[model samples]
Target: MAYAMLEKFEKYWGDYSTLLAIVIVLDPRYMMVLVRLAFSKLSIPVEVEASIKEIYDTLVKMYKF
Candidate 1:
């Protein structure tokens, strides 16, 4: 399941990356919401949620500046 989600994320990352960047720059709170929704939609496990949160948090912090 995690592998499937990663595959799907990898496929969309190129397209979503720009939008995510923009969101992070303009509004990090929204980026967090988007990340949470994406992960929820992917049915990510609770164990993996921490890593996803970490990644999104980093992205938000990196781009929010």
Candidate 2:
């Protein structure tokens, strides 16, 4: 039961992490802080940094649009 729940969590997290990060950043209270913190916890630091930059740039383009 517990294992199944954890499996579901991992599956959804992997599938929707980018969307979740984008949505969270739309909130002023969180912005990038929470997303950066969460991404920092991931295994790859280099990718984390790149992803952060990409997400920020995407947000900028969104605002400009």
Candidate 3:
């Protein structure tokens, strides 16, 4: 049972880890500090970085309007 749980954790960790990190980074108190920390910790790709930048730009634009 423990082995099975560990296997499941590994599988989901790939999907959920980034999402969880993003949630933490989105916190107003931490913001870019958390984002930099997450990107440094995780093996984030260039494409993912570009996507994140685009999303941040869109949110900023929305706030301006």
The lDDT values for all models are 0.59, 0.79, 0.61
Model 2 stretches with alpha carbons more than 4 Å out: 1-16
Give the candidate number with the greatest lDDT: 2
Alpha carbon deviation, residue 53, candidate 1 (Å): 2.9
Rank by TM-score, highest first. 2, 3, 1
> Candidate 1, residue 8: CA error in Å?
8.7
True lDDT of residue 42, candidate 1: 51
- In the range 1-65, model 3's lDDT, one tens digit per residue, is 99999788668643434445455657888876766555545436784576457557755765799
Please provide, for model 1 over 18-65, each residue's C-alpha lDDT reduced to its tens digit, 9 standing for 90 to 100: 345345545746655666666566545793476465666766777779
Reference-based lDDT, residue 49, model 1:
77
Worst 10 residues of 1 by lDDT: 13-22
**What is the Å distance of residue 25 in model 3 from its true position?**
5.9
Measured against the true structure, the TM-scores of the candidates, in listed sequence, are: 0.36, 0.67, 0.42
State each candidate's clash count. Answer: 0, 0, 0
